[model samples]
Target chain A: MLSCEQATRLTSERQERSLTLRENTELKMHLFICSGCREFGRQMDALRSLIRRQPGDKPPED
Target chain B: MIPDSDIADLRRDMLAFARLQISDPHLAEDAVQEALAGALKNAAAFARKASLKTWVFAILRNKIADLLRSKYREPVTTTDPDCKHCAPADDQYFDDNGHWQQDTQPRSWGDTHWLADNADFWKVFDACLNDLPAEQARVFMMREFIELTGPEICATLELSSSNLHVLLHRARLRLRACLSGQWFGTEESA
Candidate 1:
């Protein structure tokens, strides 16, 4: 099993490029049992979307 | 038809984005203004398929690319500020065994879409982003915000693939920690 550090590293690398099959399988297995790594993965995705939003995009009205 | 308010908004946003990529305020302004003017001049030719903002951003990106090409033609040397081996603070997240440190374990950031649109959240986001080492922030923005391909960024920044990957990885790690500490996992909440 990949450690949290290695799993998280792969999560970030996934953003940059396609992971090999072995890497994909290992990361998926790690994420399945680790809520911390899963949350880390989600946060990374959130960060990407937040950064991609244009500066002009205003907050939705309450 | 593009409304006047929309143009104003796009101009402001474009300038902000350009300034993130280019250090010089004047140069960033110049690129944005030129892009706005070009977009206006060819407004009739704009296809309806893509959002107007996307089209204008493309023009601004082209201008920035040209500026970067001219400004950074010389291959980055070892002495370059970015090339300095500044050790990232991200190592604190993991233990010697490469597991997440007990105190630094990631927690759920509930309702991220809601946070994404929260203006206060964006302020925290910007602060977290700005706190990153300058080159890391710039390269991260280029890769994520500007949608530059990996090869494109390597060529433009004169960075090797490995170097670029490390910068990007560290940037993400730090940003996640900062955002969690400041917003999602605040002392009262976590």
Candidate 2:
């Protein structure tokens, strides 16, 4: 079992697309069993949604 | 003496990309103009090593950096104290029943209709993006908002894949932490 710190780091890495499959699986497994980490993941998702909504100066076209 | 059509295209493209990096519409416009001027003056140096879009974007990034540096000597911070509720506690996922629980699954989390649906939420959201570390924020904006690919970002920022990944990871994590504080009541002090 990965430590909470290791799981946290891996989860962040996975979110960034920097983690290897092995690392991702380890983190996913850890999350499956750990409520805190699972919550962290959910929060991470919520955060992504919020950031996407942030209005920038760019026009509608790109 | 650049052609008007090319200049128009460049203006449109640069404004779009600049908006990703800069929240201020006026500043983004100014930065795009400055970048176009620099690119035209330095046209002789263009070797076609990268796409014209990438080359232009690199120049725009530099201009944006300069503007940000001048406007805020210190890093940007959140003005909303209420925005602090989004950060997660170490124990937040657990239920009162002592069972491991998740309020929402990650897949369903992509449904951003709720956030996009609210104007007030966006006010705090934009502030959170500004609060991110500058480089990471730049990368995230380029990748996510501007739809730049990894290789394109690597070429533009001159970052290796590993370095880019790390920078992006840090940026996303920080943004997530910041937004969570605002939207989800996760505690900004965390």
Candidate 3:
């Protein structure tokens, strides 16, 4: 199983590129048992959501 | 037909947007003015397929891109800030060889308490972003707000893939920590 730090690295990495099958499998397995890294992933998603809704999120007119 | 009110709104929003990317108030205003003027010149060509806001923003994005390219015309040495937020220091979040630290693990911020819509939330958001190192923030905005891809960012910024990745990671880490402290500090309310 990947350490929390390594798992987190892969988590951030996935944002820029898709993980390979082996990497994906390892991360998933790690997350299954690791709540901290899981939470870290959730935080990353929350951050993205917040970023997308930033001042320049969409082009207004909604 | 573009309404006068809409143009005014666009100018205000674009100014705020440009200010985030470019530190110079004068240059930021210049970018907005130029974008607005370009839109005016192309008024007849606008097909209205997209919202006027979207169309104008697209033009502004191009203008910002041009400005960035010009400013970085030299063989760019990207300023990769030494992140104070990454590993070793982050050991509390994990254990030796990399297992989660369990007791120090993060909790899910499932409901971010309307931060996605609150105007004040954006203020904090912008402040947090502005707190990052200039170059890190620049790369971040281009990737996140401007939605530029990795290759495009690398080509434009003269960064290697690893450099971009690390810079991006640190940027994300810093932003997350700031928001979690300022916005999500103690809120678990649904």
Highest DockQ scorer: 3
> Global lDDT of each model?
0.76, 0.58, 0.70
TM-score per candidate: 0.73, 0.51, 0.67
Interface RMSD of 1: 7.3
Which lDDT tens digits does candidate 2 get at residues B56-160?
666676566556445634422323333222233334323554333343212222355566546576567668778876677777777665555676666555566
lDDT of 3 by residue, B18-79 (tens): 88766678988998998788666656566452345556776787777777656634554654
Which candidate do you rate higher for DockQ, 1 or 2?
A: 1
Name the lDDT of candidate 2.
Answer: 0.58
Query: Candidate 2: misplaced stretches above 4 Å?
Result: A15-19, A47-62, B1-112, B188-190
lDDT of 3: 0.70
lDDT of 1 at A4: 91
Quick one: best TM-score, which candidate?
1
Tens-place lDDT per residue, model 2, A1-62, is 78554565566556556677788788888888876667556656666555444433322111
Structure candidate 1, residue pairs in collision: none
Worst 10 residues of 1 chain B by lDDT: B77-86
If ranked by lDDT, best first, what sequence of candidates would result? Answer: 1, 3, 2
Question: Candidate 2's error at A51, in angstroms?
Answer: 5.5
